[model samples]
Target: MSRFVVTERAVINAPVEQVWEVISRTDRYAEWVDSAIEVTDHHGIATVGKTYAERNRTLGPLQTRSVWTVTEIDPMKRRVDTGVGFAPLQDVTNIFEFERTKGSDGGTRR
Candidate 1:
């Protein structure tokens, strides 16, 4: 087995449903992801079991293409994404977690 270390974590402020709406839209990756990352092959066919073209750079001076799919998805619990684009980052698995709670003022905290 290989050891990998993660350096950053992303926090999106939104409800699980709302977050899913944004994340599940593979066609919108180029819009939300940083410039270093790009998403392609997002045509009419959608959802898991579909291949997505990806290009990533500025990752320790390493760049590669990866084909990814929805893999595992749970509406409110989490979504797991894996890379399969024949890139150095291939086989990469990302766990996107979702949680919500009530605030002191009776408002929701995402």
Candidate 2:
């Protein structure tokens, strides 16, 4: 098997606090995540050791149910989670980091 790492960076036109407010909620994945069909189970908050489940889109017309557990968090700065059930992929880890841009207009780089 081979290992791979994917990194994506984007500047969001919102304050870091605002971005964290949305991303810190596990139940809000479906609202912003394009591949998320629905969040099946969650406590609505992100906390270490907490788990959530989601119905996600896979290949065309295919869907997979995945369970994820929050592994780490740094208040309004960063978050990490690990998941399984997407077959052909195992123990996938996702990291989300937010940084406030140095500008007169408050924005977030994530």
Candidate 3:
């Protein structure tokens, strides 16, 4: 299969630390991620080599469970995870980035 990258961007109206608190919680992905239905087996803290289980729905009635491993993490900067159960793709990596913003409201641009 061809290698490709998919990116999603959003602007959170909160401080960098505030945004990091929510984003760093891997178990809470189901609350914000459109495809994530549930998350389990989270190790509580985010660090290299942590593993978690997630339930995802990609299309109409198409659901999947993937065991994800934390490959890299940079607090308040970036986080990377690789999945093992995503078939046809061989591998999948997800990265989240947080950038501090300077605006009247003074929040974060994620």
Between prediction 1 and prediction 2, which has the larger lDDT? 2
List the RMSD of every prediction in angstroms.
3.6, 0.8, 1.3
What is the C-alpha lDDT profile of model 3 across 1-110, one tens digit per residue?
Answer: 59999878877888888888887787787888787889967876676898988888866888888888899888988888898776546689888888987767767876
Report lDDT per candidate. 0.61, 0.92, 0.82
RMSD in angstroms between candidate 1 and the native structure over all alpha carbons: 3.6
Give per-model TM-scores: 0.69, 0.96, 0.90
Q: Clashes in model 3: which pairs?
A: none
What would the per-residue lDDT of candidate 1 be over residues 43-89, giving only the tens digit for each residue? 43245566677776645777777666667767666666677544444
**TM-score of the candidate numbered 1?**
0.69
Please provide, for model 2 over 1-110, each residue's C-alpha lDDT reduced to its tens digit, 9 standing for 90 to 100: 78889999999999999999999999999999887999999988898999999999989999999999999999989899999998768888999999999987898998
lDDT of 3 at 66: 85
- lDDT agreement of model 1 with the native: 0.61
Q: Please say which candidate is ahead in TM-score: 1 or 2.
A: 2
Superposed model 3: Cα runs more than 4 Å off:
none
- Name the candidate that leads on TM-score: 2
True lDDT of residue 98, candidate 1: 65
Clashing pairs in 1: 66-85, 67-84, 67-85
